[model samples]
Target: MSRLAYGGDYNPEQWPEEVWHEDVALMREAGVTMVSVGVFSWARLETAPGVHDFGWLDRLLDLLHAGGIRVALATPTVAPPAWFYAAHPEALPVTKEGVRYGFGSRGAICHSSAAYRQAAAGITEQLARRYGKHPAVALWHVHNEYGVPVNACYCEASGEEFRSWLRARYQTLDALNTAWGTAFWGQHYGDWAHIDAPRVTPTVGNPAQQLDYARFTDETLRGNFIAERDILHRLAPGVPVTTNFMTALSQCDSMDYWAWGREVDLVAQDHYLITDGRRTHVNLAMAADLTRSVAGGAPWLVLEHSTSGVNWQPRNPAKRPGEMARNSLGHVARGSEGAMFFQWRQSRQGAEKFHSAMLPHAGTANRVWREVVALGADIGALAGIAGSRTMADAAMVWDWQSWWAQNLEWRPTEDHDARERADSFYETLYDRHLTVDFAHPEADLSAYPLVVVPALYLATEAVGQNLRAYVEGGGTLVVSYFSGIVDEHDTVHPGAYPGALRDVLGLTVEEWSPLLRGERVRIEAADGSVLPADVWTEFVVPNVPRGAEPVWTYADGRAAAGPAITRHQLGRGAAWYISTRLAPEALDTVLAAAAADAGISPRDDLPRDVEVVRRTGEHGSYLFAINHTATEAKVPLGAAGTELLTGERAAGVLAVPPGAVRVVRAD
Candidate 1:
């Protein structure tokens, strides 16, 4: 009813026909109505170059279609077979050290290799020609998980390409040298021929050039993704095609990935958590809400959630009991159309052999299966609620491209960490039970009344203009440290730390110092209440704007001291500035007070120890009041609340147990 699609990845490629049949029954029992097939079938598709095999796949699709299951077809180019690798040796990506990969894992291919492009386009054309009209095909999944460039490919194609990339970036060696400060390193290159990707930092050279190269490399890989996506678009015109994305990934920024949105139908992201508990859970909720917002509030798929512990990380801890269901339901409540497990079944071999699955090694009777079945049923019952409920009047902003620029900084100090700052900022905001949207720094700013930009280390001139306009147009803006210091190339704008923002902020930063990883600096607020800076510390000299008020003071004992935090009027809007990371108490004290300053308030009364978020849709708003604590709690409400998940109703305050959730519908 709500355009809810059920089902997730199913790899029949791994099992016998008999086992496949058994899975169908089990899938139906779990309320699954669709399957994702062909995630790793390049080997099956082309046994040799130009050869195509649809025998096993055709049969599998026919069987699933007969059984009334839809398919989210996969391109399955994770890793090409050894024959293709041997046939086109240039296809292998050369690492930064000049070593080529021999292939063993997924995401091993050189995305830009001529061989990869040729083979990928051919496979896509064939798949589209064969299955584009099939009722069984629902969507197309591009290469899995995308990639990370841990190893640099120093091969010839990449080497030649790097030169071209530099040429496009600087155009002239003089400009390149000036931007890179090449004179400082004596490593000045006479021409493009003298430039090489920074390795070992062999001599005094421009850190900016090297960093830009890293960025160029990042963009190059992103180009490959676009190329591959274009192939899928041509092959499958009507079908929605998407590759799974990692949110806030340091190496591969998903914002750059969004540049190819014309080829993408919907946004799908993976959510994994650390073991510290509620922090991880709340973080995932914010991410899901943000992902949906990026797709213009459409329910984005939770591409591949772990059924249990992830095997890839250095330390893999299995999720605690009830954690999986709680997490899954959390996504649904926040506008996720569907939930999918990375693996429905357990792997018997390879690196992921021990990763958790819905059906454990013990088969169908295990608790995991029971949990899966229970969640499946609950989700089925709430089918009409999926993609139905939406957020209400509150406005919160999160930016993506700005996030990339923040993390790309190769800081001399430890301050280049954007994810850490972003996560902490998110946590402090979410803890207050406020619903926030992750806005791309470059996106339109006029829609929302309140915008938050954290660790804005990178801000393009255009981005600065957008922020100024938003504020001038009466939109409230909240910004944090290391902001507006650099451009897209990670080069400083040369004047102020917040260069483009100086005029709007009405202040100039004289000097700032980096604080220790967890050290705190105390700052007193306007009312004499002190706040702590726990992330990065900066001293601010406020040329205080006329309508702006200094809210927080510097914890750093300095001769010339004033408030490190301030709020002021810029046009019809208000601008709030936070110089550094503040402790939870201080951060909340400021943000909550800031919301009050902007005349913004939560749409509904809140619960004690429960963070409630409401998403407004065309019909009405969906309210999610979640219990963050372990004890039973009651959330305050003025009107009646209907539980969309259980069809239960609550009058007055809604009572919920520890770590439990209630999705309610209220106008």
Candidate 2:
């Protein structure tokens, strides 16, 4: 149960039966023990009705178990069998625009279709009945990136299902009209039959309808996941169940799925952070932190990291030396129970023809194979460090729904890139060695010493009250600009800055001066601390400025020379006010000082760019000091340690060459 669960995505079903042994031989050399199979073999499995194909899988499992390899059994529900889709064409999803989708891809089945549910349940039950007790079965991988099917259901089944879903949500068209504001353009729906999914592609329609459709898509797919999970758990009562979730997906509020914490035994995630040559260090941290948050700070897994370019990406860049390892350890350091790659072997053809693989088609002599072994050995050497947790006393609440609402704004508009900015914030905290949690806006915030809310644009009155309560209970709240403007449905609150939280903050904003892109302004704390010209600056005009004070101001002291960032000491708890959007340096500086004041500690050992990954285990704390830089970097350890990568123990400071890794045990 405690091994790192090495290896990933073996496709024995794709190759000739004879080549299976060669694959087994290679697995041993790479120290690989787990293979995710049956991800897209639905058509091949059930060529006809009531005819189950098990001989291949049975032999495959027997051979793998003999070779000491475990199976991350996939339900193969991601792609419908051609027979299933053809027989039940109604299982196809319809888009908001009313166009029907043709099948030729994975995850194309309608998530809410009864046909899909029945077929998927039958397949899962069969698999469980056959392999539940098999010693080789390790974990159940429900579906492949459940969000793959870009939404649009045209089938009658989906149409009826959509109506039912809407009924449960709004109850009646009157309520729906109020939410959709249907009276605006004479678009009021007299009947439910008149209601159809949005077609915003080439037409101008209400954005709210489109947004709700997107949210509904998330729920529909979530239903599929729930159904598959129930079947998997019932069939194999002891096996852990999980489905890989793509992080930072805006089309769906993937974060919303985290509320079903019990349905998932482990929080396994898929990340494709590389679009250009450079890595998104902050994005990586956000993915890991969000994944860990669901398990309530329990260790999660990096279920899928590409060995190279992904086919779906507009631009696929091959991972350079140390890039894969650095990314792999990035998750491990942040409470990852297991770290695995997307695929062990490259496919000759398909949508993923060029997707990078651990072992290339050229066999085991390539640099890719060599790197795989080196990574395997490095992780294997550090055996007892997967379950460790870090020392963190603070958290930040991230609300994706609110994030979407901000993007729907009319004035002072810009991209509501919460995923990127939130990552920026989290990455800065990590670089400063701060233990940060990505909590929900609705979660109880009393546990954390300090809370940082970036942009809660769509937050409700209840959310504001919750934050107020947390602050009144002696907790510090750090808020940024452009927050508290909207309701849960992306509707404006008809008030000033931080609309709903205004009363709680005891301030009224009269006017706000937009700090144009690249515009600079001075920040002078009421305590007499001053910093010159920060990016994304703004001025705050508080209604009842009793204890509220400005921390920074412009040098010229213009006519509106107020605090760029203000704060108020309300009761026992403190509410920090920030007017301008801060640059990285400014945010790090201000947050670091605030963190120190709140008694929060920074545990990352190296400077920015030098990654210090911490993992928990039964043995002791394992700190992976990885030099992601091309030039050599030095890291100072907190205590005496041993290098798990090389079995080298050290005291004081440790120097890591470029692209090198140092494993150490805390004293």
Q: lDDT of all the models against the reference? A: 0.70, 0.72
Worst 10 residues of 1 by lDDT: 248-257
Q: Which prediction has the highest lDDT against the true structure?
A: 2
Q: Give candidate 1's total backbone clashes.
A: 18
| Model 1 root-mean-square deviation | 3.1
| lDDT per residue as tens, model 1, 413-505 | 565466666666676667666666666666776777677776676677887888888889888888877678777656677686577677667
Each prediction's Cα RMSD? Answer: 3.1, 3.1
Task: List the candidate 1 regions with Cα displacement exceeding 4 Å.
Answer: 1-3, 148-152, 166-190, 203-205, 248-255, 260-262, 276-278, 386-389, 392-412, 516-520, 544-549, 555-560, 602-609, 618-620, 637-641
| Per-residue C-alpha lDDT of model 2 across residues 54-134, encoded as one tens digit per residue | 989999999999999888888888887778877988777766556668888776777777778888888888888898889
